[model samples]
Target: MTMTFAKRSGLSVLALAVALTGTASTASAERNLFDILFGNRANRQRVAEPPRQQPATTPAPRVAAPKISAPSFHDYRPEAPVKVDFAAIAAALDEEDREGGAAPSPFLEALAGLAGFDLRAEKEVAAALVTHYERNPGFIWVEGAGLNDKADAVLRVLNDASAFGLLEGDYAVNVPLAASAVLDTPEERRQALIRFEMALSARALRYARDAHLGRVDPNKLSGYHDFPKKPLEAAAVLEVLARTKKPAAYLQSLHPQNTLYAALRRELKALRASAEKEIVVDTETFVRPGSSHPEFPKILQIIERDADAAFRAEHGEVLVAHAGSETYAQELVPVVKAAQDLHDLNPDGIIGRRTVGALAGESKQARIDKVLLALERLRWHPSHLGNRRVMINAASFTATYLEDDREKLSMRAVVGKPSNQTSFFHDEIEYVEFNPYWGVPRSILVNEQLPRLRRDPGYLDRAGYEVTDSRGRRVSSASVDWNRYGANIPFSVRQPPGPANALGELKIMFPNKHSIYMHDTPAKELFSRDTRAYSHGCVRLQDPRAMAAAVLGTSVDEIGREIGKGRNARRDAPQKIPVYVGYFTAWPEAGEVTYHADTYGRDDNLKKALAKVEEIRVPGS
Candidate 1:
């Protein structure tokens, strides 16, 4: 009853079917063919049809995996045994080992053993071995051994070489046996050692250069390597290493107490002090003749006239005239004499140019320079200053006793002549001599005493001097012919130990190269003057007995007890006291400032030397 479409063929079947299909399609379109057929076929049996089913699902297609490429063996070849000149290499290696080779490596060690060098368990040899292999990589191919084994052996040799200091340089590797033997003379050994050391140092430096990829300046290396001796050569190498590897550490390693640092530190302190604002002079005025009154008519007229006048008529910053009364004159005479004594001028009561210059503050800069020089000198002071101390200010002509920064006492003193200046340094107060003898210095004996002795052979005898033989036995002064004994006197003259001796009452001994010390002088009148330079170079104290007591920490009676024992009584005072003989021309005093003449002219020379030194530049950029 249902219509169905069939597959069409290519030509003829298509034409026949086309005609029949058209007719059948038209008839079926108008009629209910299924109903008609069903009615007619009711009597006939109904044809049965089976139910339809769906087709089965298929899985997706599989993809093939990617392939990996193999490693290339294009240049592969079996490693050949390294062709080592075992004999020559061994000898060279042994020599280097003996001298101390470079950083050790296994190849170097093996090479060393081949040379019969038994450097057992030396770490330097091991380091040398590693270093050798690193530098000479071709040593890796020794046929029968593993790479590490060969390396170990090579390292052993290199380390051994290093232990011998051979790794430092070629000179180490080629040291002659004879050179190692101790020479009869130090000079010979020193020279030989220096030569060998320089060679080793040069090699080490060259290696460093290569490692750093640095420009090897032969001249610079030579300069560094050219040391005075082996120790110096070693030091130079260490210095280079320090500079390159650890600059700060190197600097720290150096002694900070060097002279240069000390000088710099002193200069800094002085500069700091100079920046302070403080008036140098206070309560200073000039006395005029006939002036018990506050002002003199003539001096007041001069100052007032100047104060009134402008440019050209300026005058009277401070009154400057003459001494007023006989009392004033007497006082002024001593002050003037003091000034004269200090400056080596005539001790007349006349205020001349030199004295005027000193009082006018014209020498301030010169005085400051002296203080600076003193500060510089202190840089070389001994490591410690004792708890109790004595400081002699030679320029100011004063001695101050200090116990732990507190002033115990002070005394007027007479210092050296302007020409024979007192030396600056610290010494210990070892002993005190009561009734000390005066053994005159050679300079005084030759220049001053000899002339007097020539004038009269009995001059010394009259002066209470005793001639003595070399053995200290007293001899008669009459035995010597004064005319012939001008400079040829073979004997010595000494003042006997007593209160009347030039070293009066007591002498404080702080032995030094100058053979100078502080002692009581019968010349106490000298200190009353403003300037005292009566001694040749020794310091003469006004109240030396008091000074001795303070220094010894004992009463006067106790000191007497010690002195009575005589025989150069040695007392280790309760404490060791430092006695410093220093020179400072200008220093702060109370509210004002005091200055001293540059009695010795050392300031000028020292200033010039300082200037020259400041201009010098150290080496090594």
Candidate 2:
């Protein structure tokens, strides 16, 4: 039978060959096994035996092929072939790596990644990054291969966009290519670098000017640069610039003869001189007892102290404390007792924490700041202040009649509650009414009396309010639903002209959008309180009849006669008085700063806004 050959498994043959290779003739045996596994069956039958080979007489000298070198991982160099000091290069690499650059230029790293690229292309991108850094030294460094790719990509975009020039429209090309250039001569390159740096500086300055940052007067800039700087002066200069059409011309005119920009220079010099003068005066002056500089004694202080004490006695502890000694309590006691005489409080020597807090807790500096703010507000007031005036201090709860800036008479007043604060404004007293019938304001009718009327239908009748129909016939208060009546009440409720009426004895009218007027309230107990917030927005005088009599230049009886006749007394008075409702936390009284509570809490709001403005730090600062 003919011997047939079959294909052998490569794994099985390799294993047999490995086992056979340990014996002599192992190479020949392995070759035979490989031929048997690969040769066709018909061919295997006819296969010829190997020819007798000549045995080697001597072993040839073993020769080894040249060792192939693995690619060097540490031999990376930039395409530009720039000479870099290893230490400096390493430090820069470390910094760049720390900042994110692990591959090439920081700008390229910022670009993140790019697939298609060449060495020369990367070098060009590196150059642009160097230029950008030179232009904007303030720019923060980014790191990593990703960042490098990003920066290079962005640089390419910029270069393409700015092919014609460095700057285009509002944008500018900034790439620092020269930083990594390998020049033939180091000295010449160094000189060129210095020139380039100088050009960059000049460009930066020009950019600042174009941006209007350098529009400020040079003198003002110098003033800001100087020691003990008055920073607010710079703001004032800016304000002046805003108000004027030509800021440069305005600055130039401040020094026509090329005098060192006189406005800022002169102002700064004056401020310094004033400061020196103040220091000298401060050393020389000896403030007298009860003088304004150190302290001032007033009757109001005593009243405040006693009032505080009374409050402390009633409640467990005093609300506020005096700044100085306990002696302020003693000093305040008598004065408070005197005010108590007017306010109907019992005279007492003990001035509690509340009273002392009210009197002495406020500092002089706080008062000055308030006055300054008020002065700023006053700048927007109208220029034509009337010759004859009535000034009402809403804080003090008092009004003064002034003729030619001289006080004619002063009277007590009851102002609005802290929540319903009296508005700060001026108005002309056009008319006055004696024995005026009360025409209730809509707000008062809706908010106050309506609720009471809803609960007790007899509220109006008990309060002497007479409800009348269109035909002037009296109507029963029970017929109305006070809650719904605000919308449906067609008839007017008029309080008859009597001393017990809501408007008291008189009413003074001034036309304003707020519907605010001066009148007298039947609630006499309100005026005796120190802090009064009793009125429904309008001002209530302690003695309205006296005020009306003074304004009309007539006797009280004649005013009563006019009202009794019910003639719409349209008599033209000889003079029209100006009335001002003002807010003043601090004012000069006996040459001292007299501080009052910020009853409306306006000071706190203004203070917070001012603090926020101060926190901002601009470039120069």
Candidate 3:
């Protein structure tokens, strides 16, 4: 019986070793293995004799025939061995091992589907969402075709978005149960989950961004507004939400933590709670303290209403005595003065439009509007405006220096007029210039000075302005052709340091692109006015020496001494002090929210802008 051979396991082992080792050529190794197992054609004649003993051996020796040559291993030389990639081979094996190619993760597919939605316009948000889940490929808000506790927590925080001055409707989202009621199939249920998941993430991101950076983009309000719109990363938001046990707390943490913001929120709550009807005083005529007017009784009533409880207790008799009188009585003067003081006015007891606006106090809705506006404006600025800084509120016509968040100095200020609105922005106070030369701004030169210079070419010369050509060389203002320039003049104009200088004795310089600074003004009487928007654009501090001292971290006497030298000199502040030039119609002052006239109508503009934003956010609204 004959047993035919088949390819054994050893053949596969030999082939694997040959591929792995790569030590010799493939052809020679295979041939040698075959020759070793089964005799080659050339060596077939050589046969082994069994036990015939010496007779058999003698018979084979007698047949010494043709010479035969065997294959030699020493003569074989392998060419360069091919390099093998173990990792690639292992990966190929892994692929072959997997039954069907890995199925796409349904969760990841839902995340990628965000690109097809409205998020396409919100590029930052889309990118962040995709990146977040790719890093953490798991469902956060959903669990097994329904919403999880985390989603419930997020919705709770979003429902109370108004507490942070954000509109609840902007972050409004419906629960997946609504979708579940409409769909019965498993695929539709999954589709509902995807929709629910994306919507939640989008709303959470919007809330996170709006809470910290404000709903209204300050830049879009008007050219006068300047602020860097802070970006909120969606990935960062999702990462925090996924990791935190208290999702509501994490969501609420997005609001600004500044004291002013906190105070505004409290004021908003109070205004919403109050039932007092707003008093409307429509008279354009000014009511002097002692002068009688037809509307005096009405003005008195409004003043009494706006005054604090303490004022009412202390001067209850005075208010009661003039309660029905038409004349602006001496008894009623204190009441008007107290109301003016409460609202941060001149407190001169002259009931003009500004005084009336203050005394009448805003309608509940109006005050709430201002508070909400103030809160939004606060969000535009840094949360922590360093320990030592200066805050200039243009609407209130005041400048304050705070050290360690405590008021160090507060004084009256004159800001830009309506035509030349002081910008709403922030910068660092770098230095103070004593007896500073005022470079006539191009705007002033083109609009005001050029027109004068055209009528009389020697106006600047008469006005004591120093004119120079494009170079630094001083040139006669009369020599230049006034008609040759429109807005772009080759000549530069500036006022030298003198008593008649526009900037009085000293100017605190932050050196911004707006060319605005806190400076002393020759026009001291402007600060006495009820509304002090008089400068070209810079802030005119009533007490420049005191402000200088505060920013320089020195004494007022030292600041006075520097100016007394009567020379043009600049003194750098001890450290850079933050100076925020802002336009806040409602601000916290002396532990109370003081309302100011919206001189530039920024509040109205902001109101309109927000309305448009809401309309876009909620299409039918």
Highest TM-score: which candidate?
3
- Name the Cα RMSD for model 3: 39.2
Alpha-carbon local distance difference test for all models = 0.48, 0.45, 0.73
lDDT of 2 by residue, 180-256 (tens): 44434544343333323322222222222212212122222111111121122322333343345444343323221
lDDT for 6 in candidate 2 is 18
* TM-scores for candidates 1 onward, in order: 0.47, 0.45, 0.77
Tens-digit lDDT track for model 3 on 1-621?
011222443346456435444537676556445544563332343233112112122222222112222111121121211222223322433454464466645564343333333421144555566566545556778887688899999998988888878889878775668454577876666666766776687678778878878877687666677787676777788788888888888877778767778889999888878786666656475777667777677777775665677887987788887786877877777777777776666778778888767666556777788888999899898877788889999999899999877888999999988888898899999999999989998877877777777667655654567777787777666656666566677888988787778898999999888899999987887776788888888899999999999888889899888999989999998899998999888899778898877898788778877776676665211
* Model 3: lDDT of residue 464: 61
Give one clash count per candidate, in the order shown: 50, 38, 0
Worst window of 10 by summed lDDT in candidate 1: 222-231
Distance from true location, Cα of 42 in model 3, Å: 99
Q: Which ten residues in a row have the lowest lDDT in candidate 2?
A: 221-230
lDDT of 2 at 579: 76
| Model 1 misplaced stretches (Cα beyond 4 Å) | 1-368, 486-488, 560-575, 586-595, 618-621
